[model samples]
Target: MFGRSKDSTAPADQAPALTEEPLGTVELPGGKGRPTPKRKTAEAANRRPLVPQDRKAAAKEARAAQRAERDRQYAAMQTGDEKYMPAKDKGPVRRYIRQYVDARWSLGELFLPVAIVMLLLNMLLTSVSPELAFLGLVVLYLFIIAMVVDVVIMWRRLRKKLAAKFGDAGQQRGLMMYAVTRVFQIRRARLPKPQVKHGDYPE
Candidate 1:
């Protein structure tokens, strides 16, 4: 009759309901009306130096960390492990483009050494044989021009293929330059080494 159920409602001597009302907010001592940082924010803030004292040591540690990271990235790149691939080499379209380029040989790869030799030969012959020097220079310049033309044609074709295969989004920023630059890098030495061999179809 006194609000008691058949099972005595709760217990013979029920504990009063413990309403958990927060005891207001505990403000930081010098908060100056600013809200306190959350636990996560405070933990993150506590980590890393607010004011660096040992700058030299900090720099050294940073360099060491960078070197370690570079080594790791290098290892990943060597095996063509896409997960750790550099930003430039991160996408499927880029990978396909690289393979397409790699499967074909580029004349530009030889330009660096050939240009150096031709210039040296001209320098040595300039006084002894002016005509010969001029001839050498002309041939060298012509070959350089040919290589440039070849690279241009290659990039144009590559872009078309890339667009056809991957649509508009395939033409990523700097990707054209990346393909163009890769034309000059020696085949074997290209980073994220070629997954395809010469004479193989990129498909």
Candidate 2:
């Protein structure tokens, strides 16, 4: 009768009762306060690759590379580095002579009519005095030569102007001279023919 009967169906040693306490308060790093979410930054918004900080240095390097390449090309063009053959010949002397000849012909064309007129005048003046005729002929020859010189100078000036205006091309100079000569010829031809007025009686 001391504590109970040991002859009962239950075992003598019993397990302790299992107790459920409130989940041990999960304490965060900053006490029980909620964690603040991280804020998004401007750097994160663009999401592009970061450029070099020293842009001037990069530009200078690029320029230096370009200059080096240019120098390399120039060195390649040099005669000592390679057998440099010119693309075309410079035939300036021949061109000058040709242009001078062309100018002479143009001048001759300009003065030929004047010479013819002077010769006709000399023939008329010869009827009065042989000396007067001789003098007139000499004067006419000088005048013709002066005219030729003047025309040549004018042509040279025009050629220079045209060359400056367009370019120093022989073909262009030839074409211009040809066109000018044709125009002069047409004008000369028209000058001799007198215009017939309306209702003019034929003498």
lDDT of 1 by residue, 153-193 (tens): 98898888888888987777888888888889888789988
Candidate 2 TM-score versus the reference: 0.33
For model 2, residues 1-203, the per-residue Cα lDDT tens digits are 56776666466466455876544454567675534333565547757656777989989999999888766555543322322212221244223432333333354445657777879989998998889899989988787677656656755665665466446563343554543443244233422121233233122
84, model 1: CA deviation in Å? 1.7
Cα distance off (Å), candidate 1, residue 114: 1.1
Among all windows of ten consecutive residues in candidate 2, which has the lowest summed lDDT? Answer: 81-90
Candidate 1, pairs of clashing residues: none
Q: For each candidate in the order shown, give its overall lDDT on alpha carbons.
A: 0.84, 0.52
Best by TM-score: 1
Q: List the candidate 2 regions with Cα displacement exceeding 4 Å.
A: 1-113, 170-203
Query: Among these predicted structures, which one has the highest lDDT?
Result: 1
